[model samples]
Target: MLPPGKIPPEKLREIVFNRLGAPGERVIIKSDLGVDATAIDFGSSVLVASTDPITGTEERIGFYAVHINANDVATFGAKPKWFLVSILLPENADEALLAKIMDELHESAKKLGVAIVGGHTEVTPGLHRPIVVGTMLGEVSEEKLVTSNGAKPGDAIILTKWAGLEGTSIIANEREEELVKVFGREFVERAKSFISMISVVEDALTANEAGVDAMHDPTEGGITNGLHEMADSAKLGLKVYAEKIPIREETLKICEFYGLNPLALISSGALIIAAPKENADDIISALEGKGINASVIGEFLEDKDSKVIVENGRERPLERPESDELWKIV
Candidate 1:
């Protein structure tokens, strides 16, 4: 069986996506690997939709449920407006736990200016913890719609914020006691606060306005797999500079302690933008001006087979992560 992360891109294309039914003209963007959201034409505007499930950690699960799905829609240069979630409660769950989850959902959605229209909630047997699956709907103008496949050769690949943001928070929250012993309470608490950085809506919209060709939020497979997804979707290659990739101090310490690669951990707060080399700096500045850290990690190459990571003069093929490094500890 596949491990607990995103399905491999190849199998997803062959077994799952290949079976998608044909859509009429209303479908602007159909299901595709690496693509974040699908779009349907609605005359004046395009309705963008994305769905994601939150099952990794129980702490802040409600907040994660909304942000993860909304982040995908935002990557399409859309503003998330409506949300629907499926809440599955574990057996023997109490009313207080359910109330807490509902309150979190409401607070999270309200913060993002999204409405929780409707959803189904049920108590299931043989479950250990609660799971929230969210579907987000957003809207974008026709000209502003961006897809993952829009990246072109010679485009500079820019990463906003730092990698492993989500994984660090999850680890700190889920294994606080274990981490506190090794890294002290202060460090663990700082790492746990990274959950506040999970939303990339502003980063995505800023890059879109700055003439970015493609935008993606690295989720399950982290930055390494995120780059692979962009390259795969665009049918291009990437030459990433390992030293150029942004890694936060807290993230580095946490991953080192856990013996996990920070680059291959789930990172929802980071935004990947591919743009023309000439416009890359402006895009970076735009994001940084908003208190978001941005860096040029690499460039898209002409050769489709060339996915290289240059680090300290050494070269290596940037392989797609089979599963998120978070799974190792979680």
Candidate 2:
């Protein structure tokens, strides 16, 4: 049987992506492991679309559904304008639960200046909690379009925000009773607030304007998996500095308590940018100027096989994470 998290890349290629029946002529980008969103040629502009399901935690599922999907469209240097959602509730759910979710969705969409176009909602059997699957749509001029495969060798890799941002918040909310006993209610609340940082729309747009060859929203498999995906998509190698990767104190504490690797945890708030070495500093500055923390954690290498992370002056191969570390706990 397959694992509970995402299907392995090799299996995805062989079973899912490769099985897409016929390719459309106007399809600018097809489904792939590292690609964030799909682009289709539409007259003078490119239409970008991405969909994601929120299943890890129900704490802020509605809010998460909007931002997470929007982040993907933003990664392609597109402005998300319309949203569609499919809400599946458990048989035990009530009207209040649906109302709470819809309220959150409305507020989140309003904050992002996106309109809720249409969607479907149903009470699904055998489900224990609610699941919101969101699809975000946007358009971008051809010149402004960006994709994960655009990263070039020798380009600098810039990271926005910190790692395990989403996982930290999820753990705090899902296991609040257990964590509060160990670290007080205040700390848990602070950790839970990490959800507010889950949107990377600003980070991507800012980096794109500052000049970036590629951008990716680190989602299910965290920073490490995201890096691997980018490299794979671009067919390039990379050398990352372990010390350069940022991690918040809350994420560190929560991961340590569960003996989880923060680097392999789900990281939605962070963005991965590939930019020319000359533009890396400008990109970082632009992001920081917008109050978003960013750093040059690595650079692409010429040899496609040379993927490694330097730690304490020692180099070790950077292996792709089989699954998100958050799964081990939550």
| 23-112 per-residue lDDT for model 1 (tens digits) | 567998877779878999999999999999998888878999999999999999999999999999999899988899899999999999
Q: Which stretches of candidate 2 lie over 4 Å from their true place?
A: none
lDDT of 2 by residue, 108-137 (tens): 999999999999999999999999999999
Which consecutive 10 residues in model 1 have the weakest lDDT in total? Answer: 16-25
What is the Cα-based TM-score of model 2? 0.98
TM per prediction: 0.98, 0.98
**Model 1: how large is the Cα RMSD against the reference?**
1.0
Best by lDDT: 2
How many residue pairs clash in each candidate at the backbone level?
A: 0, 0
